[model samples]
Target: MSELAVPGIAYGGDYNPEQWPEEVWAEDVRLMREAGVTMVSVNIFAWALLEPREGEYDFSRLDRILALLHENGIAADLATPTAAPPAWFFRAHPDALPVDRDGRGLSYGSRQTFCPSSPAYREAALRITGELAARYADHPAVVMWHIHNEYGCHNAECYCEASAEAFRGWLREKYADDLEALNRAWGTTFWSQWYYDWDEIIPPRATGAVPNPAHQLDWRRFCSDELLSLYKAEREVLRAAAPSVPATTNFMVMYNFDALDYWRWAPELDIVSNDHYLQSTDPESEIDIALSGDLVRSLAGGRPWLLMEHSTGAVNWQPVNRAKTAGELRRNALAHVARGADGIAYFQWRAAKAGAEQWHSAMLPHAGTDSQIWRDVVQLGADLRALAEVRGSTGTAKVAIVWDWNAWWSVELPSQPSGEVRFQDLVRAWYEPLWRAGVAVDFVRPDADLSAYRVVLAPSLYLVDDEGAANLAGFAERGGTLAVGFHSGAVDENCHVRLGGYPGAFREALGVRSDELFPLLPGEPVGLSEGGTASVWSERVRLDGAEAVTSFASGPLTGVPAVTRHTHGTGTTWYVATLPAPSTLADLLDRIRTEAGVTPVRVTPEGVEAVLRRGEDADYLFLINHGDRSAEVEVPAGAADLLAGKPVEGGTVTVRAGDVVVVREPR
Candidate 1:
């Protein structure tokens, strides 16, 4: 944020000139220039090349790559090449192989194959990183140091002695030699899982034992800590050498690895970055992308994050590999900026000649710059550079949505009464409506400050750590409008039901308690909105201190409290007991919007999503046409679309499908 140095929105992605011969390097540079790529990430997976055998070093190729990027006037997003130890090194030190969850030693066939706790792996990684940092720390072209690639896998850590010792140390720090407390916390009494001693706690093995969710979850947490330690080690070395350059490790968005606790690790990085690849095709797609981007932005306290990796076109890994339409890319890119993105970079710059990613799309397909994808990339780069002045643009959201990863992890660990009640689906059903209407929203942890937000929405908030619950109580008591949805406040952090009532600690705030819940099947109509019956998952509610705002129309508990509102100290809490249809949700949001005095960014004619971002000096409103048909939007009197350089004052703004029009409004 300090404006001492650095340009806005540097562009480019992983470049592997080492994979191709020198002849292709010229074409790569030419095409990169054509596409306006101002940055290049180099040496991402070159550990073997850097250190051929033991105690030997080679930088000839890396030197050429750096020189090439600089020669082409592109900044370097340099990598330490520690992601994978080379095949030769692995062959030399077979003990460096990672151990699977089931206790089998893995062969080095894929990347992400090194055990985090392995001393051999650590020492070698440090040597490589130290060398790379020492050499490139002073390079003028280097802008940032990318620590590593995605740092997660289900088969993390190992039963090998190294990992076991590390796990013991982790437990010692957390439990302080109280193994009994650990057993109790894990609910080990059910299957006689109580451990007599800490050593008795073994890593989950596929062949020898039945799965234990608690132990599995704890293992995941420990593995994450181990990887964090690894990243910190590299980060420290890089920092000591080049303290001014930013450093980061790419994060998997909405990832469930490690009890979903990204908030814990986000602060360690200089800037937040994530890979976004969702498999949904709806008007809400942009919203989904925005929510994830908002989550990252919120993690940084409204600072911008980088879109480190996204598919340029269809990825071969998905169940359905659908190429994005011409305008889909631009819309999605702007969506990132709309939420708070400083940069947009794809998974790869060039499609692989032969590999798992061969079929994956790229900015330049196999045909290079002649491809249509390259044309899109060129245009996107131009637009972004032109708009770079707004790199740190901030958006003000009157509404705050509370998302608790602990609750998500704890709820899924238990075999729920039915699989129909999923954590993610419930959240989407509740959040989609507010998002579609172009409401500026923040995704914060339950413990985040709520005094700044006018409206607070908590969806499927099953986990309530004591401090988090207290924060919620304070927020509601201090005059904030709270919305509580289905399966919320049902249990404490330990997954134990609150002794006093069904709604648990939030009962006083919500002013309601229920003895039973009704789960409806798909296609089954459980209630009605304003005009017709609404289908899908619905819950029956009983009111205590709250009054019914709406009721089920035809269920057994018909005309009962489907939705209730309770008055707190200076605010009101609305409890929605079921998953309502989209229209019904929009209606509820409309009410909240009115009560909170939260205005939509704009009032468009039709088929346009209105977005507004406010920076230190300027505020820009975006009119996005997400539909197939052209949309005619009516802007405020003296506004002009910055992207189009056109003014719309006579109440008419036209936009084509997937078109994004940025309107700069005078403050």
Candidate 2:
């Protein structure tokens, strides 16, 4: 992949000069230079300002803004600003507004209020995008083109008349206009819901009882593709107009925003970028940064990607906006780079004085240059400059986790066996163990090539198709260590139960057969014979050809197999029937990883993260200490501490509490 057109790591944040007075533009640029800023996204939500009236366009303010940025030597990531249509658009076409699941009509004013499938919205969006492209195609300030704001944030799925028609069209193409095939795929015979005509099928909307699971799943897929089509339409227009500049939209790929299937969306994007914010509720929110960055980089196929938006301190949306501590901001930024980001950016350059996100933190906060936030921003800019060589470097992972949006969507549908089958929780539970074990792992598509990985983990994978199952079995057969978690392989692509037994797909490979699942209560954890407790889940399993490594010590099905191991074609498969305690799970995972001959990038003490990114000349090692005490980090002989600008005296660099150090070791 071609990197962003910048000398080093791309810096700066979203610049919304239109929100401020023209007189302030000079001061903003002066401060940007002070912070060593390089690039910024402009006009992200400026549709109303750019297109004031129907078919009327204004580029005067944007032109001046670009000229000022160019004079200051700051690159621009010009946005099309199609995410928010003007109020006049809603007035002209009220049907463009998205409808809630309850069939309630939504009003304008909020961002992303327009439905994705609306023809009027798409046409108007593409027109503005084309105009912007034609104007700034050759502008010296422009380096990249940002297509839209975050997709599917406010209106993930709409239940309007137009959306229903669009959904019908999408389904027709999917089933090749075969009504019987559609019925068989949807399994609509249970409630006499067979569709004789194409028009009879509508989105699964506002039903009294739980709607057909298959219909709901297809609706989710259709909604995602609908927005993707919109993005592609806009991308085509931009491609023809600004053929050189790369185009991308901000993706919210965290556990909180799991609407789009990024595996499908990654191919459409010229640059894989995302907007990530620390969840206020989680005490250990830094892990979210690592997870989100790895996910983005995997979507980029191990190429470096961009951190489109993050907050300097507190974000305005959470229930309680807690500000970052003194050194927390810098640690957060560098962690993203350690995972795979080549660029670091924020939500806004200067804090807004008015509007919805007035209180959101920024590079230039409302306190101006006299505050700690401003000082930290300046220091971070220098830190990035010092470690610029890490850009375009690729990180390697020996372990891969299977994650699919279809499985996530299907596993959480209503009327499940247990309420604790949360998709995000499952991923985090399995991922945190690997994180603490200091090994790098990549999240792969369900049907992706798994031969490169030494270890593969599928946790709570409740839904899978034949090809995906075969891929997993083939990986195990090729001498890879495979770990299967509870509730996996229960259903196929059509959401129909893989009958005969639970975990139907992998039963042959795992050598275990289970007919019933004993879902434990929230607080009623069952005891394991291996001196630990397993919570939330416990399955009754009988060994077919596998060996029972452990059993349930106390539960409904006492003495039942709790964990089993089977050898299938020279490789081993371990099936865990319950969510074990973290320590036990970590110990088990480490044992299996060691058996498979997979080692960490560099083993370090607790709270100190070690990740290696290999470049053309050298391998860069990022050591981040999340603890309070100082940490002595050992590097290879002749390694230099890039941050300290000195060679290691005794192959050791003492990283202070709440600090980051990057070591450069020759390959």
Candidate 3:
């Protein structure tokens, strides 16, 4: 499959020409040319304007917008405009609106208020998509189809009657209409929750007590499937009408509000794309950005993916809305490129004159083209053009981190072992060290192929089915080093304990079994045998064949194994019994990396990132310095810095803070 339809890195972003007058479009195009903008995502939220009433369609504004974009030599990532249904449609079909867990119907005015299972909403959405595809399928400016805006951003789950009925139907198909099987899987017999018929099965609603864990799990699965079904319906229409244009929907990969399982959704997309906004509040937001990019690239199966949306400056939604510092914007853009993004797009072209996002930053800020944001945009555009040869290049990684959304949901469900045990935090605890060590890492699903990786890190997995457990064991048995962190392999898919032991399915592979879990109180930490302390959670592990690498020096779990390593077949399995401090975690990973013989792409001092991207004939090393002082980075001999146009025959390159250097070497 083709990576991107455009020539260079796709630039520009969400453009809403329908929001402004016609005269402003000419100036918009002029500014786009001045800024070297190559593409724009248009008509994302124009449903109200596109269809004022049922069966009524208008394309006059859209036609002019596309024509203007083509005239300015800008490609269009055309949107289906189904994210926000028209107010009139919702008024006519109130059943389409979503209801919260309290059973209160959500009103229009905000985007993504329609329930995924509403038949009326589905019909209207598909009808408009057909109209859109029929009109612009062959347009010269349209390069790709941007299906509905971020799916399930607001109302991922609905407790309304329509959704309840749909949920029952989905369950019937999944269980083959066998209530006995459903009862056994859900363990409904535990609390008199057994069902005699499908109709008796409703979505876990707002009960004072905790809902059935199995029901909640299935409800999440069903909701994700429903959203995927909607995307498929529109994708089929676009495929029939405009088979040439690839279709994609923007994914919020690392966002807190994500509902759809992106692993399942990635297969439905013709091109993998994601929308990532920086968290200004977190000092480590850059790390999150890199993580998200790696995940999306992995979702594309090591192919170049598109960065569908990022902010040019401060996002209006955050509490503080802090603007990007002087060189931060440029660094942020290049970080995505270093990971494997063929496109760097933003949330908007022009700042909204009036809306919820009126204060949001755009390529052309409200200050016009005279602002710093516009200058940065133009500079990034030029940089991307100069590095056009980097397009379609891929990054290689020998390290894989297992990330599963089901595991995330299961670990965070109510009544777990520890309320403070966050899945993302645990994963990041392992990822940050690898990132700092200049190691290229891929985020893989639990069932992903493990042969390609020499080392795999699974942190706080908490939920693993039989197939997933076997996959891990196979990886270890086949000469791959595996690291399993605390709380993994505890439960089956239905949130039921595996019944044999803690770390249930993986007990044999890990060669360690836990008898009890001890969660520490805040500010309390147990000393590790290696001279550091472990906190948050600790397990009393008894080793079968594994040798203890680190043991708890004090506390209730004193002298127990805090970290252990066992050899199985030709590989080694390492288990972490508690969350170690940052320094200790890095030390542990460094030892594992060395033992696995996994080489870093480039080793540099702290605060500097080195990533290698390989093309057909050339390899590019991207060196980014995130620290305040200059750092010396060792580069390949006879390499030429692409940005500076200088040869680095000295074998070391000095990079200043907040700057990026791309070293080009002949493959």
| Reference-based TM-score of each model | 0.93, 0.99, 0.98
TM-score of 3: 0.98
Q: Which candidate has the highest TM-score of all?
A: 2
lDDT per residue as tens, model 2, 1-667 = 5568987888989999999999999999999999989999999999999999989988999999999999999999999898889999999999999999999999998899999999999989988988988888899999998888898998889999999999999998999988899899989889899989999988888888999999999999999999999899989988898777888888997756879988989999898898899988988987888888888888998899999999999999989999999799999999999998889999889999999999999999999999999999999999999988888898889999888899999999999989887888888888887887779989898799887799999987899999999899888988888999999999999899999897789999999999898898888888888878888898889998899887899989789999889998889999999988888788788887898999988888889988889899999999999999998877889999998888988988998899999999987
lDDT of 3 by residue, 338-394 (tens): 999999899889999999999999998999878899899998888887778788899
Give the lDDT ranking, best first.
2, 3, 1
Worst 10 residues of 1 by lDDT: 1-10
Residue pairs that clash (backbone atoms under 3 angstroms), model 2 = none
Residue 273 in model 1: shift from native, Å?
1.2
What range of 10 consecutive residues in model 3 has the weakest lDDT sum?
1-10
Q: Please write out the lDDT profile of model 1 over residues 163-224, one tens digit for every residue.
A: 88788788878887788878776778977788897777776656344456666666767877
RMSD of each: 2.6, 0.9, 1.1
Model 3 misplaced regions, further than 4 Å: 645-649
Cα miss at 546, model 2 (Å)?
1.2
**Candidate 2, run of 10 with poorest lDDT:** 1-10
User: What local lDDT score does residue 660 receive in model 2, on the 0 to 100 scale?
Assistant: 95
